[model samples]
Target: MTEKQFTIVRELDAPRETVWRAWTDPAIAAQWWHPHGLVTPRDSVHVDLREGGSYAYTMVEEATGDSWPTGGTYLEVREPERLRFTWGNPGDAEGEAPVLTVELRELEGGRTEMIFHVLGIDEDRASEQSVFQGWTEAFEELDDALVAAR
Candidate 1:
């Protein structure tokens, strides 16, 4: 089967180190891990931050109390540069889960260019749930979190 993937590129107003922490630190991640209507409680995020380590987070919809538990293993971890991991439910087999890769490049003036790519989701499903839209909104939230940390 053909693998379906999507990539999002954004320039963030923060240093590469700060952007890296936002992705790997549970406390920072909780601030913007979910879509606009959902919330990721700080206590619900776990990050091991190692090549073979696993991480998980739960995004809860406050209005309905619905939660989505996502967990994945780190396939590659290079501090302040790149990360590749599987994206799926807790205990999912790596082979069957989607893969996500994040690449960070330091720019002039303490800025960062982030490239986020994901594979294994079909185009139809991605569109039906507005996955791209959700991530875009989440990135906006991440921007706010980065600014607040400054």
Candidate 2:
């Protein structure tokens, strides 16, 4: 049997533009994209908010002093609406870069629904589980950071 794809969604009470900005801007990403207590030094993150573009960033856990690098290329980008990227850790034993799709839908009363999908990990259930758990916490942290930053 192979691993299965996963989808995660969160309703953020922030405007679409605000949430979009947080994802596309490196400065803002440095502050929020990473998990809480994970420090990504300023000027080390790169983001290109266009189709076919690429980005690379690092995440450092402050307490354990662990550092991990993440990089991926954009497969789709629609401002304030959707983003698709190929995501992978690059050095894992499984060596797969699952496709990550983020769809943002704007709702009335200035809210956005952020839906994230992880695909292409059909042969490694353990990896899928780990990624799912990590992303779950990461999204919650992102929501917290977005609220505070906005």
Residue range with the least summed lDDT across 10 consecutive positions in model 2: 121-130
List candidate 1 segments past 4 Å from native. 123-128
Tens-digit lDDT string for candidate 2 (1-150): 656687887899899888888788887787765655677766778887788898888889999989988878889998888898887664643336778898889999999999888887433336534667677667777777688768
How close to the true structure is residue 4 of candidate 1, measured as C-alpha lDDT? 85
Cα lDDT of model 1 overall? Answer: 0.90
Candidate 2's clash total is 1
Q: Provide the TM-score for each candidate, comma-separated.
A: 0.92, 0.84
TM-score, cand. 1: 0.92
CA error at residue 112 for candidate 1, angstroms: 0.5
lDDT of 2 at 69: 87
